[model samples]
Target: MKILGKITILLCGSLLLFFTSDFPDFGDANSPASLHLSPYFIEHTLEDTAVPNVVTSVLADYRGYDTMFETTVILTAGLACFLLLRIPKRAVKNRYYLHEPTGVTLRFEGDKYPQESDVFKRIDSSWVPYDIIINFTCRLLIHFIQIFALYVVAHGHHSPGGGFQGGVVLGASVILFAISGNLRAAIKRFGEKTAALFSATGVFIYAGTAALCMVLGENFIDYAALAPILGSDRIMARSHGIFIVEIGVAVAVMAVMIWIYYNLSSAGKQDEGL
Candidate 1:
């Protein structure tokens, strides 16, 4: 039975690889991908959507339903991390060395000490307070990162950036803050409760704006109905709507990333533990 199972798995894998050979080559100028749908997006997206970045237009407008699901995937990952690793209210025993000798000449009952160096001295617990430095730096970086993330989200329509790229960057900054500072500090900046709220809020913003078009007797995401409120012509409304949704995506992604990192690193410690 085992032999038969292994053979079946190998055959299936080989068939998958064989079929994949028919897929488009990466970055081939003459490939069907480059010549067909992509060409239309590249040459005409700016004229149609009034967005200079064709990729952004494709993601936010032409193929926005896919983008919505991608954002949901991020949200799912964050929730999974939170559920699997959230800190329990009760405290658990922490297993870390309080004090141990460092030198070349120490071995007793299958224990060994590495050779001492000046570098080790600097990093020694007696000399440095890891918590304090990490907390301070993390606090400072969060503000700067938030501003930069907003800029990336806003400028996406005019340039090579967009919601997904900017959202990931924003998410990473929060993750960095979590790693450098600690779970508690990171949560203080944006708690899991707040993160969940913002995630829903982001989706609402995107869907609500699109729904506005439906209410105005147009297609779901037809931005032409927003021309009056957005202070632009029909063409420009699409760009404006895309920008709004990008902001929503940025908020959702940043919150979810921080939430995930906190749950992972802390390892379910209600109080600080290593």
Candidate 2:
């Protein structure tokens, strides 16, 4: 099976390479992609959208529906993972307790735990010795990571990063917490329910903004129509609308990434995940 898969991949790659010879060379200025819309987007994006980053203007404004549906795609993927892997609630039949200093194990049935036993703190089923260095490092880094992620999302109009890139960085901080500490602790901070809600909410924000433009008597996804609601001129309103949808994209991507990670790492049980 493995050899067959390898051969199949090789054949597909070879076919793709053969086809590529008919296309223009890398960065060919006369290429169809460069000649068609790329030049227009590069020259006029800032003038039309009032955003310094041409890429952001093109993605969040010029191609607003595309961005909105991409966010939907991420949310759908998260939902699909949840549906495929999430285990239904059931009674836990076994429990294990570890005596910290003494290094002893106590087993019990039917969700038994150490109550009033100060010597044995209630630990995750997959708990390991707490590494002070790792825990403290993650604790310190998480705040900075999240702050930078927000900056990246907000400043994409002037920089090289945007919603999808920033969202992935933000999600990594949560995964880092799980790795350095425990899955339960990470989930406690951002639970499955909250993640699911946020994932849907993000896509809603994007679609809702576009739909609102239509309600205001403009074409669908016509951000210029939002000028009255946002109390800005048409050009500025389009810029602001791009930022708003970028925020939505960021939120949806972040939640979806975390949701997928939780389901996959825990094998759908969401307990003692790596």
Candidate 3:
């Protein structure tokens, strides 16, 4: 029965592949995607939305619904990690004994030290001390990185960036914080509670802005209605709305990435034996 199931699954997959072989080739100018939606979006989006980047327009306005789903995916991932890898209030540590191929052994007690062996000592102790100057430079670069991430989010309308790219950059800045200092320090700066709250707040900001549009008697994402408050024309209102959502995405992504790093680094510590 198992063999039959495997064979059936393989046959079905092959049939699907066979059918897909006739689909339009990627990046072909004559393909339906290139000729139809792409051209229309390219020619009209700039005039209608006042954004120079076609991809940004597609993501933020032309297909804003899809962007909403993408944001939801981030939220779902954060929730799953929170549920699966949550650290318990009380956890124990395990002791490990290190043994070398050569017959040397070292035992660690109560998470105090790593198992030590002669071979391990050579490898671990051989690490040259990092230079203070280099560490200082890296610490300084983190500030610049955060500033650049904000620029990316803010300037997304006129260029090839948006919430997703900007969010990744912001998330990477926190990873630098983790690498430069200890994980505990990174968490202290951006704790699990703060990360979770930021993520929720980001989504709320996006949704609430759209809701406000609805209350003003426009469609859920009709940025034209927001033009009065934003102090801009309809097209500029769209640009402003996209910028706001991009900020939300950056916040959520940065928080989630930090949260994931924290959980993964602390996983072994969570399962220690008493």
TM-score of each: 0.75, 0.86, 0.77
Candidate 1 — what's its lDDT?
A: 0.71
For model 3, the superposed segments whose C-alpha errors exceed 4 Å read 1-16, 94-134, 268-274
- The residue ranges of model 2 lying beyond 4 angstroms of the native Cα positions read 1-23, 89-93, 99-103, 111-120, 124-127
lDDT of each: 0.71, 0.87, 0.73
| Local error of candidate 3 at residue 188 (angstroms) | 0.8
lDDT of 3 by residue, 1-274 (tens): 9999999999999999999989988788899888899879978987888888888878877787777767778877888877887767345333333355654535444536553445543121222333577568769999899898888888888877777777888888887766665454566587778988988877777777777889888998776778989999998898788778778777777777766666676662322211
- RMSD of every candidate to native, in Å, equals 8.3, 3.2, 7.0
Which window of 10 residues has the lowest lDDT sum in candidate 2? 88-97
Task: TM-score for candidate 2, please give it.
Answer: 0.86
Q: lDDT (0-100) at residue 96 of candidate 1?
A: 25
Question: Of 1 and 3, which scores higher on lDDT?
Answer: 3
lDDT tens readout by residue for model 2, 1-274: 9999999999999999999899998999999999988989988987898999998998988888788888989999999999999984344445567787898877767654566266875565666777999999999999999999999999999999889989999999999998898776788899999999999999998999899999999998889999998999999999998888888889999999999999998788786567
Q: Between prediction 2 and prediction 3, which has the larger TM-score? A: 2
Whole-model lDDT, candidate 2?
A: 0.87
Model 3 TM: 0.77
Candidate order by lDDT, decreasing, is 2, 3, 1
